[model samples]
Structure formats: structure tokens, C-alpha cells
Target: MKLPETAKNRLEDALKQLNLRPTQQREHVFAVLLSERDHPTADEVYVRAKKSMPSISLATVYNCLEILVSCKLVKQVNFDREPTRYCPNLAEHAHFHCNDSHRVYDVDLPQDLLNSLKSVLPKGYEASKVELSFHGTRVDTTPSK
Candidate 1:
């Protein structure tokens, strides 16, 4: 499962920057995540990946994902006790979880606003990162037939 040259270059460059090996499995897994922006769990990624890499195993998929997260090439998302999901979007944003559909959507807030949210913390506090999420149902606006 080989990615196009440009895609391959990007993935390899990122791994190189972290002084990590860009193995075929790692490249393939990253391709799978990039192909679909939707946040998917390890099992979901494994299913998508094995389509091309028939010999790939669930454990390998998990390892690839862990490496990507540690390298900051992807972000791990968690909601309550649910299985962890992965997101490739690195921008500063929040997540919206739809209670009805159980889907996660990225919510973009201005840099200033996100910075101000830290004000709610104590005066002596410091923040390494900020995470915000909202849970709600999507209202159906379709008119009755």
C-alpha cells in the first residue's frame, strides 16, 4: 500500500523530523487517517487499513497510531469511557459530540477567545494545552412531508 509521491514525502518528512522510522505500515496507517478526516478508533482504522495491507494486524495498527500521536502527527480524542479516537487536524479547536448521532465535529474558535478561556483558571496557574467540548443533540429542521 503505497501513497502518491507527494503524500509519501509528507509522511516521511514528518517521521524524519521526529527521528523515527517511516515504515510501510506506518505510512499506510497515516494514509488511512488522512484519507478520512472523521475521527476513528483503532478498530476502525484497522478495518480501513487491512483493505490494502492484508498482512497488517490490529496490534500493528495500534502501534502505528501511538507513534503518530507521540510524533504530534495526529491527535487522540477521548469522550468519557468510550474508545479513544484519532484526529489529524492539528489546528487549535474544540470538539462537538452529537449525543444523538455520536459523531464528533471540530469547532473552530478564534485564537484570542481560546486564549481567554484560560482566564477561568487561577492567577498562579499555567496551561500546556486547552481542550473544550460540547455535547448536545442536533435539531431536525427538515419540514414535515
Candidate 2:
């Protein structure tokens, strides 16, 4: 994947601030996430990143993602899944996952829903951030074989 000059510069700056050497494998993995819109798991990013960095290990990919997350270049998502996914968009937004395909999508819910959720909060409960996800499949779409 071709990473934009802005993304590369951002990555370079991040590595410098973190006092970490920039590597081809780490750059390739970071490029995959920055170049694509879909939030991807470590394995998914690894498959794409491996094209440019054949020697990159799965464990290495996970470690790189963790580093990126710590540097605020990437965000990790935990939504009742074994393998957490990472999002390149650091902006506050929600996601929806198609349970059938396991495809993730950004979501924009109604204001009423967000307001209603806050209204129902129990005592001593504070909503840090809203993360709403709707998991379902289209009625007419056939499931993967």
C-alpha cells in the first residue's frame, strides 16, 4: 500500500519522539492501517504487510500495533472479540460489525440515542465515551461458505 507523505511524516515523528528506530517491518504494518479505511486485526494487517516485509512475524505485528497504540498513532478496539482490532481514525466515533462477515464499519447514531443512554446511567456511573455497535447481517445477503 502507498502511504501518503503526511502519514509517513506523522509516523516518522512518532518514532523519533518515542526514541525508537524506524524499521521497514514497522513502517509496512503502519502503512497498511493508515492506507486502508477498514479497521483490521493483527492477522489481517500482517497478511498485507508481509507482501513488503516477508520476514515480519505475527508476534512482531502485534507488538508494532501495541507500540503505535501507545504512541497515539493508532487506536486498539476491544468489542468482545479474542483478537482486538486497530483503527487508524483517532477521532471519537463508533463502529458496527457485521456478525456474518465480521466486517467492521463506522457508525453515526441519532442524537436521541446518545442522550437517552446518558439519561439512563446509574448512580455513581459516568460515561467516559460513547461506543455503540450494532451487530447483524442483511436479510438478503448469503452467509460466507
- Quantify all predictions' global Cα lDDT against the true fold: 0.90, 0.84
Q: What value does the lDDT take at residue 111 in candidate 2?
A: 75
**Which tens-of-lDDT digit does each residue in 16-54 have in candidate 1?**
998989898999998899887699999999999999989
Clashing pairs for model 1 are none
RMSD of each predicted structure = 1.8, 4.1
lDDT, residue 48, model 2: 86
Q: Please write out the lDDT profile of model 2 over residues 1-145, one tens digit for every residue.
A: 7767888888889989999877776778888998779988989999988887788899999989998988899988777855799998876667888888888887766777788888899889999877777778756777788
Model 2 C-alpha lDDT versus the unseen true structure: 0.84
For candidate 2, report its TM-score: 0.79
Q: What lDDT would candidate 1 get against the real structure? A: 0.90
| TM-score of every candidate relative to the true structure | 0.90, 0.79
Off by over 4 Å in 2: 109-119, 139-145
